[model samples]
Target: MPVMPVDRRTLLKAGGALAAVTIAGCTDSPSGHASPSAPPGPDVAVAPDWAGFGRGLDGRLYRPGGSGYAAAHQLFNPRFDSVQPGGVVKAASIADIRESVLFARKNRLTCVPKAGGHSYVGASSIANGLMVDIGNLRSMSYANGVLTVGAGARLYDVHAFLDRYGRSLPTGTCPTVGVAGLALGGGMGVHTRAYGLTGDRIMSMQVVTADGVFRPCSPTQNADLFWALRGGGGGNLGIVTSFRLSTIPGGKLGLFILKWTQSQAAAVIRGWQRFAREAPTSSWANLHLDARSDGTIAVRAVGVSTTGSATAAAAQLESFIGIRASSRSFSQKSHLEAVRFLGGGTSSPRTGFTAGSDVLRGPMDASTISALVGAVKARAGAGMTASAILDPLGGQAAKVPTGGSAWPWRSSLGVIQWYVGLAAHPTAASYNSARSWITSGHRAVAKASAGGYVNYVEPGRAIQSYYASSFARLKTVKRKYDPANVFHTPYSIS
Candidate 1:
């Protein structure tokens, strides 16, 4: 899980206060590196003059010292405190991406593809070498109930593009996250329990391979590559420029937010586990924990019901927990509004923060919950906020058989995103303790379920282990598509 430090407050009092922070900004260096700055490794090959090729393709060339170099290297994850890449190619179309790839191949330089630049691990936007920024390739075409979007598109853009048609696709809750990385990594969201992951809706992909060849991949063509792209992780294959997604009819949804205290956490968790097993496919719920400076813990339960009947959904949810909500915000809104709600609204701050995630398929005992609450409560005084979010995963996500796609964790019950925030400088003692708390929670959760989501990988875990039983098959696919490991990144296929 990507662990980020957040400010703490009781769930009841924190809702409106925390929702005001806006999460949109550029994460770039003050002095952009427009020139070919050498990487730390020994010099091996010289980069080609892609400026000429870039000019020919998109009429946009960002060489070292260029005016657009600074804007091209910015990303959504501000925590990545690295210098901008040596050069950036801002692609306006698929042809531009192809030309950039061919130039990189000829120059024998490593190429990094960037979309929304929201990757917390620095996988989407690299610090050096050739960088292809696809942020401008934001075209969306919908025909025959299918929507084809450029890989550079963001979730909010897609939502707005499809809103006119009264259609929607399965995507993450975060509006700023890139559609490319989210879909490729088995996207989970508030609507996931009803529509499956974003990858499940993919009909085909347009990608530029390591050899500079652009091709379409789907079940009928380049099947192996298509399967690998589903959940095998991005940057481990070729550069995906566009995705054809299956569209679903958009409708009203019932959204609910309930809160409880630390003393009731154990009971709430146990009750939630039982509720998930019996909850209808149209209903999805997630538990969020927030720490308070006074050593108090607040638990917030956010849920959505596709059936659009808040009263009925509330009855089903209340069967497990007996706490009457002090406040209830229930509404029948459009898919985009639901996105705005579950995504924590558009006002969330976009400051740099560390985040970690995990996937759970079995039960998390009451003792485990108590221990986690205790640890987080203790750390809240130090300005660290911990959150454990549970997302249901048994709808269309489980209907797809195991091994059917590169995403191996098909049998999981849900995903648990254990997050903590770092506001100030990270001291060794504080860092180590935070890491230990996260690690301990993972171990405790793993004891019940060893499977983990590739998108939510933590530090020190083996890449193969994260895949669990599907590692062997993934290795074969990785070898076939990326034999030279040219697309390799941290925790991806070697």
Candidate 2:
């Protein structure tokens, strides 16, 4: 039976759209709408038969050959277009999440949660699996300086909601990234040094696990689950419904975009490695090394000083440049504007690309710096766009114990993100070229740094690379909460 895909705006109200069958085996919400815990178990057999799932759901469903089906299940990277989901369920609320989980569990469908759908490895969209699409659960609020974000809310919406109250949250640059996905994976951005990873500000969360139990997790209650949710990557132990996060100053911030010629690329990378590590917490910066079509290396640094003064940010950047930049642009804008600039403003460039990331513990020596430079140069020589970003990551972030959160990269001073842009239509040669470049680049920095960032997914890497020593504990948490592995992905704890 074919079904039409619909967004939340037009779902359910369309007459005779879906069979209105009732769902069974759902536990009552702990709170009035949806609230806390239940004992963990693998008792999904109690759920009503799976055939009634479409009729039992409170939102829209799209099967193959249905209208809008392709659009609803699309991944961020079109390169993964070869993969297709068995179906798409556009869940409208937490209750929908409950039903969706039971439906998957009862029927034995390999269902995965999807929010912003920005996962690099296509974890959000699985082949021959169900996509519990929560993109429509985007409710948000800010009161008394605290922000409550629905797990499905995109980064741009979160910013717009908070910006209205003259406040903001320390989040990533990509406007379309889901709040839950980024926070769960240890989100970073220009304000991270001044504040901290977005996950660090999470005060509480609502998660629905494999056992069909809806619960509230915080520092004091369900402590283990809460700790793991803060920094562990998404779609691992369970599906998060919402997050309660602390807010930060949302007024205008100063920005700087400094660029230097190809000859200055090595010196700039060398200088930035030293300056950013010790730079004041008031400044959060990143160095972008772009390899042009002609294979010439170009250096650019874009950042905010938190100082809210154009002069201060430029001067701070100048101190690191030491050598004169070929060009400089400075501005003082609202935090939202800064975010928009980084996200490339609405219509993002969709060239197929893949990237890898690592956490650098401290400053790199000259030899290590030269090796990194060599890696970037080799990728650029291939005639595709390539960039290596060095983002500072140590201020309040280092104060927390490595084990304090599931994100074990807390002790690092910076992150090295190696990326190679691919042709929109890639051949076997092009695919190997992009993959090999990033792989070699990662190896070149192996001695200088260790561990990887969960947000930038690599297809075949081990889970330990991202979680490090904490992987053991995360596995325990997974066993306790999701023994049956209902919510699983390529990088899942299992």
Candidate 3:
């Protein structure tokens, strides 16, 4: 869902990614969005045509050059840095979200809502259009083990809040990721195999449709929209205001990491194709290999299991990989600690990168494995880091029948991600090179992968890869919810 942002994915269910920063300098507003004492001059984008749009809301608005505009305008992926919104409405409440939708109709301008700003391909942004930022709409409550998360709540907020109650949800690793965005796209995480995806745990949501109406959706209420909301891509059907998610009790966890040299990488990967796919639902494993500038392939196998002790997890690891690991370590940690570690809590990870991933029915063929290793080494020689991962998707997640949700990829054994690094603020040369490498890497993986992950979206990809057989059904719901093409982006349900 959040793609669990970091230099690589933080390992979703660990929690998810961060917001991007820019060099543009602007003073922060002295007041928060919920405060009503704020001035109004800069709230309307300084246009007579925009004044009513601002007055119709209880939140603050930022024009291109308004105070806090620079801070609020940054997207998670800088690939679309050229696409600047005409204005950003920091919605203060559900009412503000409804007003923004109606305002978009009156102005005849495209309006996109942004929460947590982590769309992998900048899907939440639009060029010269209105952006309804729900950053200020964060207010939450938990009753009877159900967390009613605000549309604007981040993964960090959810984790911290749930930690207080010893409850957890399978989600992306990045802490700053928007809860609504992740669940909307059918979130996956280490806990997914056992507890199911973030969306799977969702009991209900508050959505603002194209008609500017706020309504509650669930299996029994607004059923069609609820079906679409479970796995329909974000900003596609309607603006979700709140999510009532069922949480699982969390406790101490056993974490395992096994590392091997390049010579052993293949054997480990070969074993991964078999064992990782079959690991216990309470146990999830991932394999990571990076092409280092030193021309060496760095391979590591990591996992978390809720069903066993550290020693038991280690023994399970031994059986998982028949070959002895060159280095192995195991630790006992609280769920929050382990989640943070997997999500990359210690880095300046919010930077630019090109990511291409694939959904596979099974493990990679022998040739694809060789090609992947070769590709990594080749990219490393080019001074670009090529990182790939084999993330398992079975366990409880596979129990949901195909078409049970809009995600429609229950047959997937796992996903393979190949991403090339670019500078936080990359040069044309660096960006182009990373794009080239990712393209080449993507092609190699496509030999086995039938589709791509929606959360880690790539530019210009067909919707079939992400939604598969669910695309047509998704389209029907999209048309019903947004017949005027109000909630749309480049790859939106069309």
Instruction: Please state the error at residue 144 of candidate 1 in Å.
Output: 2.6
- Local accuracy of candidate 1 as per-residue lDDT tens digits, 1-494: 12111110111213455331111111111111112232344454654666567658763767666886766676554444344666678787778787777676566556777776655455555556677888787789998889998898877678878888989887665665668877777777656777887888888989988777888898888888888888776677788989988887778878777767667777777777766677887887777666655656677677778888666666666668776655566767677776566556542344443444566766677667676566566666565566566666777877662225787777777666655555433444655666666676676565555555655554556777656776787788778765655554455666
The total number of steric clashes, by the backbone 3 Å criterion, in model 3 comes to 12
- In order of appearance, the predictions have TM-scores of 0.87, 0.87, 0.89
Weakest 10 consecutive residues of candidate 1 by summed lDDT = 1-10
lDDT of 1: 0.64
Q: Please write out the lDDT profile of model 2 over residues 285-329, one tens digit for every residue.
A: 677776666877777776677878756655656676688677777
The 0-to-1 C-alpha lDDT of every candidate, in the order given, reads 0.64, 0.68, 0.69
Error of 3 at 364 (Å): 2.0
In candidate 1, how many clashes are counted? 28
Candidate 2 local distance difference test against the native: 0.68
Candidate number of the best lDDT = 3
| lDDT, residue 231, model 1 | 77
Clashes of each: 28, 0, 12
Stretches > 4 Å off in candidate 1: 1-17, 20-47, 50-56, 63-65, 344-349, 381-383, 401-403, 424-434
What order do you get sorting by lDDT, best first?
3, 2, 1
How much is the lDDT of residue 271 in candidate 3? 79
Candidate 1 global TM-score:
0.87
Candidate 3 weakest lDDT stretch, 10 residues:
23-32
